[model samples]
Target: MTQPIPPQKIIVHQLGRDYKSATRIVDDILQDPKPGQIRLRNHFAGVNGLFDAMAMQGAIGYIPLTPPFDLGVEAVGLIDAVGEGVKMSVGDAVATTGLGGAYRHYQIIEAAKAYKIPTATPDYLAIVPTGISALVALEQVAMLQAGETVVITAAAGGLGHIWVQLAVNMGCRVIGIAGSDAKCEFVTSLGAERCINYKTNSVADVLGEHYKDAIDVAVDTVGGSIFDALIDNIAPLGRLVVSGYASEIVEGAKPVLAPRIYERLYWKGASVRGFMNALLSEHHRDAATRLFDMMHAGDLHISLDPTVFKGLQALPDAAHHMMSGQNIGKTVLDLRDGV
Candidate 1:
């Protein structure tokens, strides 16, 4: 008979407001899978700066959980054990993405909630939650059409980069906005017709000069001033999808004067719609399948941040790095090598 594998677990514990103040490494043990559950030995966990920061501060308006919760959402791993009624075999690669389940070395999840990873690559780390948001927001929420002009803010970031590729593949003219010249170049290389360095160039001015009345769909991830600028330049009957407000999430959100928005949007017939993946949970599976297909066919590209935060102890630093605006792609934590 084969020797049974030993159980091991390590978690990043959040104690209070701020990732630094709240997060700590804790030793844990894996529990036996109940029926319909599968135990995962996690390999990689994707990090979301806004989500992590907001979660640490207890400011994620949509999620009601308080402090003392696990600190991650998405992870890719292999099945270490399977319980009764589970159809998957041991050693199957899978991904689990949701609230409070991903930051540890081992996780017990419902087999139904976990999606089998076609291949165990780092890119799927982004596809699980971030790429799903990008794909769904552009295809479903924005209703993007061919030959239209699409503007994506934070275009070199995790979600933004995928949006750029998808929009480009959809036959749309893409305009990407990034924080620096290098990031602008990165976005441009992703097939954006134009890349605006928000730090140096004025978004409204650039659009007004070249793309005036041309934007058909605008995806705004960084809100505040940029959101206002996109609205100012949007074409008539355009759709502006708001997936996140990183500016507000990190620095604090400021209220836009009603008159400022009214003047820009009233006659244009443009609409600003808020989007949260949680609200559109029903469509996640289909979107993930499509994204995976696109990725497999080389129609999509996934960029992982060069900096790898290994082990549960580095999660707090990874979160901070993401929020500091230095990471060019998806921030990930490697949990496979032991905590």
Candidate 2:
């Protein structure tokens, strides 16, 4: 006779910042009903900006959680038990991402979307690609060509840094636009040929002289003013990739691109494309594996700096630190560290 599966302890965590009041509330959800999904003991989970935004808008309804909807989007865990049809073994290490509900000690995951973390690869590195979705979008969706001049705004960010390295490795001359000197240096360290601290440099003066004609591709990770600044500088036949806006969540803070910008783009024979990485499928991931291979070979370095947070209870503070851009690398809440 087959043995019955064992029950496991699971804790889900989340935080919501009120849209108007900006008050933050975090809670640990108990998912002990032992639902019909693969039970996993989470090892490391990383925070994301999208979760923070959703929290601010009070849009946590879509996410599946026990009581408090878990806010994390990606995590690495070990499979402890499986529901009826799951194929994973009891001790297999896997990483689940995208469908929300991470931040936990143990949780259930649908079978198909879970990825097995290779024995040689660390779980933290496996989680990197999932969180840097924008980088994947900029590289794959855009079909960025080599030897072109590419511009990336907010170049110091998690997604932006990967985009810079990916573009550079593709043989593109990258120009990074960052808010501070430290951010500029960060981009430069990632191999961006030119780093412009937008706060200090005149966009027009810098681009007109350096690029000569215009930027071949503009990967705008920062929306609002930075997006506005790139409109006139984009080259003829250039592709403008808008992937995110981290400017301000205070509502009406990030103004949409004006109609005139589209008109200008049309006149210049350029195209503006909006991308969401969630739309990428397994085939797209196969293509990105080439980039990842490069990363592993050191031809394109894309590892996140390890920032360890204490425990599940401290997720609120870590989330705030992430939102504030205080954490340099991926802030991983080590589930086993305290357990």
Candidate 3:
């Protein structure tokens, strides 16, 4: 009888600012699942740029990194083997999210961590935590209402795109913010009433002039000046959900002498909230279910970036493309190579 070949996976062997300096792709012996675990033949792995950077650089204290750690997050795949006492069987499709074991040809993971799905596809990667974060920030955190004026930053990207549609679905008027003319158009096409190109137009100027005291909810991913803009013009009783500071992820926070936050937030009864998806796991199952139903019912659109990065060897380039803020939508690595 022929023996099965080992699978391959990527790991961060050292702490470095760049992917090439920090990571190594190595062959992984495909081991059978332990009890209460499942072995998945990963079809696609989500490329999360911000998390990758933090892991690579040891930036965040909670996610402590030692040498040679598993280096990817969410993935969609098919179960090829299940361990003793496990319910998931061979050929069952699944999606798994948390951290690590995602950028591989196969993954042996805890059964509880894997969610059974109808099909193993890249679309699941887009909506699981990505869309769930948007949903949670909108509904649970922001308490968004229909007809509310909403602003979404980096609106043409993966997470931002989902919220734009979700807000529109809720009957909210959306003002999107992007980096370029084409991105602005893309955001508008996704149902945003308008998209401001920050490179061309001052975000603060635009919002202060037209949207001042009108934005009911602002979901901001790109921080820096854009965040200032959102806060400066927020309406009375408005809510701002800080989903990410993508702009500051790389450089760290720049020192800016600015007015106290309460000065802007105090009188209006407005507030700012930070959202970290992992810390809000209790809401995940419900959010995922809602998003999946929306997708299945044709009420949601999953946009995958056109640039293809196939195989484990392409991870560095893929991670860089996303971290550099170049991707149009969800950036995923196709793991079907030589499978």
Candidate 4:
């Protein structure tokens, strides 16, 4: 009888202040799943720029980050093995998102946690957690409404592209904020009414000049001046959702010596809300189901970034590409070697 080959996975062998630098592609051999568990052979893993960086730095306050931690969250793969009492069969494809599960050749996790899908495609990896985040942040958190003016920062990125399309589909007038003209164009092609290039244009100036007092909702991941500008121009009763501060992931949140946030909110009855996906468990399934349907029905699209980073060895470069603010779409890691 032939013996099974061991799997390889990535780990945070050390804590570095930066994510692209802290990672190590070490050899990993996961044990067989226990009863009610399934062993997955991951094919594609989503590159979460901000969270990856934060997790490496041990900056996510709620989650304790120790060395030798598994370093990915969202992945799509096929079941390589299944334990007793597991409902999913071997060779069934699934997509999963959770701490310490992805970024590996194979993962043994509870069968219930691995959501079954048609196949292990990059599209599933693009949508599972990232698309779920965008959907929940816009619909559940921001209460996105039709005919409203919606603003999305990092608008050409994974979540932002989905946000733009979802808002547009809901009949909202969507405005995207990105780092470059090409990215702006990309967002506009996705049905955004306009996209502000933050690199060449002033976010505050553009919003102030053309969109002042009209932004009904804003989804921002890039904090700092962009956040201040969104605050400065929010309409009365507008809602701004902060999903993640990509700008401040490595650099800690800077204490701004400006007028109190309430000063801006009190007069307008506006609100700034923070969002963490783990904190909002109630909406995950609904959001995930709806988004998957949307994509399948052609109402939503997944724009995978052109750059291909394959295997555990390429994860660090993938992280750098995403956090560099240069990637035009979802940066995906193909797990099949040389794929």
Candidate 5:
């Protein structure tokens, strides 16, 4: 094989209190892979709005870094340089997830952090980090069971859509809540038993009239009023999984008067649990394996937004687009041409 070359990368020269001002594209020289590291030619990088925003504002408590740091957490690529002691070889396809290595055309990553994949495609961006979150959160945290009824907020989104399909495949009846009629239709097409247009209809009223005391598991990414409504409608021993607070993340958390958690949950023996995929890193490999298997078996489908962002320069705009809630599915930055 021919020798691989270094590539350009995105850097945060100064932290933007918001997404737009945070990042800049720059030419970067990739260092040769160190011992136990493998260099990758990144094909596509995943855009996670919440993480991008928090990372820009220096709110990522777990992996603190000063300015002039790289951004992005996940990507799919082919190995171009394998360092001494690394078992991977040139041209091997892989998916890697770690902070600060993805938004570049080429990445030098620890071999242990990279997983061999069947193909270097943008789809793996959905299957690895995003899909695994759905799998682990529902299976491990919520302990979702077959034949139960699940209600998912933001159910037409990247993560929520995966959850809807997974729940349906597990023999669960799913009620999906989306913001628009188009999104509701999309969620319904994913096999949700019902797709509620939360913008047009009252979630609480609909649940109260038709699904009151019947939701066995509630997965909420949008918090605020939607979360409170789910809390009020959970069945006996139901599990409420709090995966994110997208609403609060963008609009800021607002105060609302609602029944206390003790009042809403204690009477039914139900429980509310919060899940962060980062906290369940140990299971990521297994979860990714399972999700890929499902995808290959035609039991899983990934949705990508119609608009595609290209090159490191598009990162900030992509983040802003996602935060604006205009994306129907996963927002991806395509770097296959190394732009």
Candidate 6:
């Protein structure tokens, strides 16, 4: 028998039952070969809450698939080889988001789905569309205005930290609410004027005492109890944006009532808008490029303090760490360092 050359690939064959469960990475493409696509050599994979939720929910019947699947949304890498009519070269560094299965060493991507990141950008900086999602959710969906007083829950996290900086830069007085004093301090270091310790102090008291009035906007990243608490602090005509529900991932969760929330919104003449960073087509690329421009101009600063897991095996541990709030900043998998 003739020997075939080894192709490095990170494969996720199945989904796990719990948040702590991990995925598997194999050395070959497990799926039946699909026609007309190019295999890409992976570089880096950006991790976020969406990927975690999808994995835990076990394929929600939207993507036309069953269990035992590859699960990753976005990654940055280069095209290794091409199939029929594919024009991209072997060395193009591109960013691919959406259509899960990105956390691998090599995988096939449609040529239209990949956006080429400029050569001048660094890998660490280029792998920042997760932050871009936060920005787009805030600016596009919420429509925050200048000189507004905004409250950002979980303000020290990957998305929350970016929200704080973006709000601050937009002339908003940012009140960052974090789980710990250290996290609060971290948000403050990122230009938040006020950092609230939700664990120690009461949300109502802090908002009333410091803000003296209802806030113009509230960006809730960690929902559940904290989101409920924010309801009492919104100003008339205040806008509330819900991005993630980190608090619900832990045990003993409950559903929030929409009618009551709507009642509160109506009583205060306020608005509660739900937004996720799942935009289609050019919107993702547009947001990413805009954020990069801000990064290049030194106007925006992102905290990359979390641990960088090397290789595909570390992916499971990294996901657990992020889900548990053990990660400080952006948690990403460095796929290029090893297979």
For each of the candidates, the C-alpha root-mean-square deviation to the true structure, in angstroms, is 3.1, 5.7, 2.2, 2.4, 2.7, 4.0
For candidate 2, write residues 1-339 as lDDT tens digits: 545333222223333343224332343343532344676777777666555565545554444334234356677778877777677777888777754446556677776666665541333443345434645576666668888889987677666777787788778999998777887888888888889988888876788787744788888866776766677778888888887666654353554545766677887888888876656664544644565566557665544546666556566666677666665545566666544
- lDDT, candidate 4, 74-94, per-residue tens: 889999899999989999999
Model 4 misplacement above 4 A: 1-6, 19-21
For model 5, which pairs clash? none
- Residue-by-residue lDDT tens digits, candidate 5, 1-339: 545444788777788766457777778886799999999999999998798777877777577878989889999999999999998899999999988889999899999989899899888888779999999999899999999999999888889889999999999999999988998999999999899998899999999898899999999999888888898899999999999998887445777676557988888999999899998999999998899899999999999988889877787788777777677878899987633
Candidate 6 Cα errors over 4 Å, as ranges: 1-15, 19-22, 30-38, 59-65, 83-87, 119-128, 249-259, 279-282
TM-score (C-alpha, index-matched) for candidate 3: 0.96
Work out the TM-score per prediction: 0.93, 0.79, 0.96, 0.95, 0.94, 0.85
Q: Residue 251 deviation, candidate 4, in Å?
A: 1.0
Give per-residue lDDT, candidate 3, residue 26.
85
Where does candidate 1 have its weakest 10-residue lDDT segment?
A: 3-12
| Candidate 3 segments exceeding 4 Å error | 1-5
Please identify model 2 stretches exceeding 4 Å from their true place.
1-37, 55-68, 119-135, 253-259, 282-284
Task: Encode model 6's per-residue lDDT on 1-339: one tens digit a residue.
Answer: 545434444434555554345455556653422345666676777665445565555543345545556666677777777767766677777777655546667777777666666641224333346666777777777788899889998788777888888888898888999878889888999888889888898887778676644788888877876777677678888888877666764342586555667777787788888875654234666777778778768877767645768766676677777776666667677776633
| Ranking of models by TM-score | 3, 4, 5, 1, 6, 2
Please give, for residues 177-202, the per-residue lDDT of candidate 3 as tens digits.
98889888888998999999999999
True lDDT of residue 274, candidate 6:
80
lDDT scores in order: 0.83, 0.64, 0.88, 0.87, 0.88, 0.69
Residue-wise lDDT of candidate 1 within 27-88, one digit each (tens)?
66768899999998888888776787767777778877665677678999999899999999
The per-prediction tally of clashing pairs is 1, 0, 0, 0, 0, 1
